[model samples]
Target: MVALSFISLVGCEASVATHPVSGKVVLADGSPVGGGIIKFRTKSDEGETVKAHGQIQPDGSFQLTTFQDGDGALEGEHEAILFSPATGDGHNAVAAPNFPTKYRKYETSGLKFQVGPGENDFVIQLGTR
Candidate 1:
């Protein structure tokens, strides 16, 4: 049974603690983004970074998941990046940009949030600039 005990310990050690994270993505006019992705990346004090991702729904609502579905993200400071695929024409159609190009990259998005030990509900606002 020694091997079984060791396996259990390994499994426990591989799990990371996470908290629930949910939010809405809206424009300056308070309109929903429709469809897209939202990513939350954190720079940890231990020099390791963790990332969580959520898909924006039709109503612009989203629930973040890190290791599992709706499991949320690690508690820390995070940089949020919003990506909305162009929607318009059909096949052979050019895709238009939704938010500003700067918001697509985590380094330049300028959107920051703090995930606490409990539930985190945020409202992300996108601007023209």
Candidate 2:
């Protein structure tokens, strides 16, 4: 009974609020990235790091989801990372030829964005270098 009560309490506690984030991933020449994964990572005021990610659409558009589908991410400064590898095996395979590998890691990606209240939209450009 005690364990059940604890679980119920935990479930009842509200989750961190998230704002809607949408964006488009493009290249320096203004061409859409087509297929890839884009992530937005940031640390909350409480020092807990949170992340939101989305699959880059054929049109390079994406909608971030942190906790739930289309729920978005926490508002704050975020580092962006976009990576698309050549065709492989599985549902995670993304066909992004000529995509730079440096953008795969956040530390070397050199991409950043600031999320605000309400709807936060962006257009991220990745370089071939």
Candidate 3:
């Protein structure tokens, strides 16, 4: 049938297939960091653009869902990027409501990681560059 053929064709392609990515973002002080960007990048063994994107969450928690056929992300060397709540683009962001105003030290620059297929638990500890 056409539906079966379409599914077969989709399975033949290599892409970020269906999967789930879950993790937590925190500061070096073991405190939760809220409101920032998290970027995931993967490079194939053949130097191909595997996958890349920036996911943002108000809290230090995230879950990336990959779909079937078109959602299975390639497994390989991966990197991550995390922005802090205290500093953004050198503008010197203010402290979060959970912390004191003087404690403006939760923002982070770029984070890195290695990703594979399956559930992944991550903790991002942001430090000054």
Candidate 4:
């Protein structure tokens, strides 16, 4: 049973090494974004793509996880993106608080980060323009 379970887990994801990544999201004025989801995506040297993300705390802090909680992301250049929470349910839903719309898309967001060996820390500050 242990072997079977291990195989199942291995089948789900390739055994790629991930480094610890944690950070805070703040506005230009140094205020926390408050609430949202932040994602980091990158392609491995072997052409495999890995993604990691974490829920933003009320203080804007976050810790990334690729497979397990706080396991982090692969070592490489990562494209970043943020998704604000919805204000209402269903059709009346609106984006959380206020953040630039560009942040919703990785390409236009102009957000990038480098993940290296060991623990990685960052402070993502949102720009006004």
Give Cα-based local distance difference scores for all models: 0.83, 0.83, 0.53, 0.86
Q: Tens digits of per-residue lDDT for model 2 on 50-119? A: 8999988899899999878898888889998887646776887645645576777889888888888999
Residue-level lDDT for 9 in candidate 4: 78
Give the winner by TM-score: 1 or 2: 2
Clashing pairs in 2: none
Clashing pairs in 4: none
Error of 3 at 52 (Å): 3.6
lDDT of 1 by residue, 1-129 (tens): 999999886685357678999999888889877677889999655677778999888888999998779999888889989887656568665443366778899989999998999889999888743
Winning candidate number (lDDT): 4
1-129, model 3: which lDDT tens digit per residue? 999998886675534343455677666787666665455656556565544433445576766533342243456555555443445455766543343322232223335566667865677665432
> Per-prediction TM-score, please?
0.77, 0.80, 0.54, 0.81
lDDT of 4 by residue, 30-76 (tens): 98877778999999777877789998888989999999899999999
* Weakest ten-residue segment in model 1 by summed lDDT: 88-97
lDDT score for candidate 1 against the true structure: 0.83
Q: Runs in model 4 with CA error above 4 Å?
A: 1-14, 86-95
Decide which is better by TM-score, 2 or 3. Answer: 2
Best candidate, TM-score? 4
